[model samples]
Target chain A: MSDQPTGVPREEYRPSPSDIAPKLADLQVGRTVVTASIPLSRADLVRYAGASGDYNHIHWNERFAREVGLENVITHGMLTMGSVISRIAEWAVDPGAIVDYRTRFTSPVVVPDAESGAPDTPTTSLEMTASVGAVDTEAGIARLDVEVTSGGTKVLGRTQVKVRLS
Target chain B: MAVNTELQGSSYPLAQPFEVTREAIAQFARATGANSRSHFDPESAAQFGYSDVVAPPTFAVIPAQRTEALYITRPDAGIDFARVVHGSEQFTYTRPIVAGDVLAATCHVDGIREAGGHAMITTRTELTTADGDEPVATVVSTIVVRGEDA
Candidate 1:
């Protein structure tokens, strides 16, 4: 099979596990459009706290958070950040392989039911809707745009992911 | 203890230069479950345009850690050591970062807001090099404090 569409001798190709011959590694970042609401729960926060050992007061104590000026014990930064990139690990040949990645914090992620005085939400992870914001398949990279919202407010906003493909 | 609500741009007092070793990056890679030979294996790293396996793309967490020093961890932060929550963090690389690279990080207070009585603080840090001041990456972190009602 030939990659040349019009017989111009194209210079792009995807990598197979056995071959590194990609002078064809000419891949460009692609976009994966997505939509999902971030679900936050007290328990999920607790679990993540245990796993990450982030005992920051801003995270779990609703009253403490309110005392200082917070809506509730908001979710952890790493938890949400981890969620932002979790998909890449799932898709990459390596779980945590990334050539480069970054994002700017635009909003705070508030877990549902924390302030509504209702029962805790069923999940801890922010239910994020990710989409391909850009792509460079020719460079073997893709950037995913992720947004997790609830009650019409963006909980995790401006979350982006960059992945190095196999 | 009262919290400082007046912090603004350039209010962050962080020493400019720092260094990262392969060991520290390897450790972070392990904690993140992305530990690969190129990241820790010096020989394997030499194959990828890196002196060492180069840290993972998300390795910015290490420098971001230093950024924590720029903010004060206080009682009024409304954070219950027992109940604090993890909010969200984002890292953007302006240039590739590698192990054994000495870096300089400059941090700024991006924004501050009040939400349901919680003090939301956004801290931004730019990682660069001493020689050319080229930006390597940026980290924007958001922390929401849930405090007791007055």
Candidate 2:
């Protein structure tokens, strides 16, 4: 099949489901899945709020967040979860491979407002790392332990996903 | 204000069926930076074996949250809207939700507790076909409402 329809550059095409199916043998427990970083900008938050319909003032209104005792406007917890799963989908080469996912918002991700002079640059970055926590070959499921941190502080805790390798 | 423990085990009625549309899927995919073709293009989605555009996994939260509001928004629910913080989210999908599908959500309060002067409420929402018994997805959300002292 042509990769043109998927828009995935031919060179960057990670294994599709079929290809991943045959390589299940390589998915061992304790193996690293992938490590990625997603920079969070106010624009990303705005777009996410619009998309997810989570218009919580703490996520958008700086003054409201401050008044509520938060240091600054924070990123939506669900947005952080979405960003983490997008990385997993990229690694699996298919979003459908993920059947279950969960996470705990242990700490708030404080996103500073855009710089006074530079309005387009991201102010913070969330680093995510995932590892194979368990594998059930017979069930075609693999459990991934994901950690999301911002500025070296844990933001999401007990994050995990169950992916279908076959 | 003390946590409303009485609401635990309360089950709300099924919400109005929500129609999953192609535009909604595309918009969510774009916002989350999920560039998968299955979430955007119907033809490309068919190649992946889905009957229609598949929504990203987190999309289930939309319907679940809507249904959850029916319980949390009650005047006597003891929830302070201004003080609530989303603590966690978990999703287990019976199958990926696709565009053109209509779904309904039924929510039940699983538990409510107070710790360190804050209220923690856990709720579960079951998403199913609009007119059938087949399950679509289950979402579990935990919300924390801070007490005045904390």
Candidate 3:
């Protein structure tokens, strides 16, 4: 878990670009660079719905999810997509450096409800691994192939991210 | 019910401008667990050569979805929102979206077809500045609507 302080503006804890951005000269194709596990809970679904203006009840209401033939409440595809890219932004050191991103949603991330005993625990996590797929020295661009899975099943397929190097 | 195949190649422009704001960017960043300073502080964003707080790349979907609603909500579209599932998404950005940008989107229905007991619809949304018409991003999305019997 991130040790970032709660209730404080994130800018106060900002890392300088020089400290975070990877050097293009040092990058090698096929090298695994990023790995992370992102946890999700029911509260996160509600928060994402409010933020993205996607008030689909299937994301928050168990009854509605069942009515829609879902096993349980599920995470919004965009929420999962949006959350994983932050790690890439950190690796590239600048959010603006990313120019293209694409993914195929192959499976739904079913976020189970909290157990009777633990109300605040996370229901599941997304395990992610990203590697450099290609590097264009003349264009100053690098492409990354990211694999994201939940419960040992792939959720996003053929995921690719392109970043411009400074 | 199957989606209206006639809507293919039709375009729907958003009726209202989407005014990007710092608060909205901050909220989206928090919800997605993006802790980048450029997404939260104007000063940091300025240092990074942006006019205001920078929005995460995926933020474009907010406006893109609104543009798509013009088609999705039409009676002829034959979409049942509850049965729709996101299939794929692709985004190509000219630059990162920043706070203070007034934007608008026009969604184009690229194709609609039935396959394996599902309706697959593809849409492309072009997001541009409301004032100068500068291209910001292009979002392509595919949604699958399951057949009733399936």
Candidate 4:
């Protein structure tokens, strides 16, 4: 398992919808809502593979990845997609608030071997930022446009999240 | 090998119901680093008006992909699993999944076409409650199979 905890403790971050209502009320189009740098290590990939039941060797075996024409072992697109959405959920103060989410796998986040570094050390970090793309006050829904990048290159494109605020 | 175009437009209904459990939800939440209490604590979820622990947004992919496998793994489907790469994914949910709900997915291979010698396959999966068949979520996935020569 990955030793690094990527998110805050549940107790410290819990907020009811009533609690987050004010924050949602202040939402403005183009306002930045969340910014995070989530780290990914090989162990994290292994853990996700187990949990998601997606054990494609390209995610865990370096040689196999190269044979498949990839630059190196890469993080699963679904893993990246899944991990980044947590930021929106945290910001909305409700995991179930999100009704729509989508992303294009524009590029791979290559995870190099950790032999030279500590086993738990991250191979790369996903730099994620989400901004209010649109706010529909009547419908009480907000559209969030998320940008996810690794190694200063966009990995996921058109990453959009729609959350119910009311 | 090129993907079997004949499989396109085919639909595969769920082979069995997937019983959602708190333990599985917690494991997936931990794995994805989603730390919301609604994913683990029933009390917190109840506070949000859910009957039980609520699954994270992307949790639908778990059961959806299982149904998708029934199509992609067929010998006639012609997908080279080792060479397949995710292209895009989208999820639209009618409701959030909660623990204790029995879910089943029906997968449709919506499209399959050759692009630049590679196979571009698209699938849409509908996930619903097993008993009442209440629609919970729909997952759309696109995967590309790299050509051997490429």
For all predicted structures, in order, the TM-scores are: 0.59, 0.92, 0.95, 0.94
lDDT of each: 0.55, 0.83, 0.87, 0.87
How is the predicted docking of candidate 1 categorized under the CAPRI scheme? incorrect
Give interface RMSD, every candidate, in order. Answer: 9.7, 3.5, 2.2, 1.9
Q: What stretches of model 4 exceed 4 Å from their correct place?
A: A1-12, A21-24
* Cα shift from native, residue B143, model 2 (Å): 1.0
TM-score of predicted chain B, candidate 3: 0.97
lDDT of 4 by residue, B71-109 (tens): 989898999898888999999999999999998889999
Best model number under lDDT: 3
User: Least accurate stretch of 10 residues (summed lDDT) in model 1 chain A?
Assistant: A1-10
Reference-based TM-score, model 1: 0.59
lDDT (0-100) at residue B27 of candidate 3? 92
- DockQ for model 4 equals 0.68
lDDT of 1 by residue, A35-58 (tens): 433344665566555544565666
- What's the residue-level lDDT of A157 in candidate 2? 96
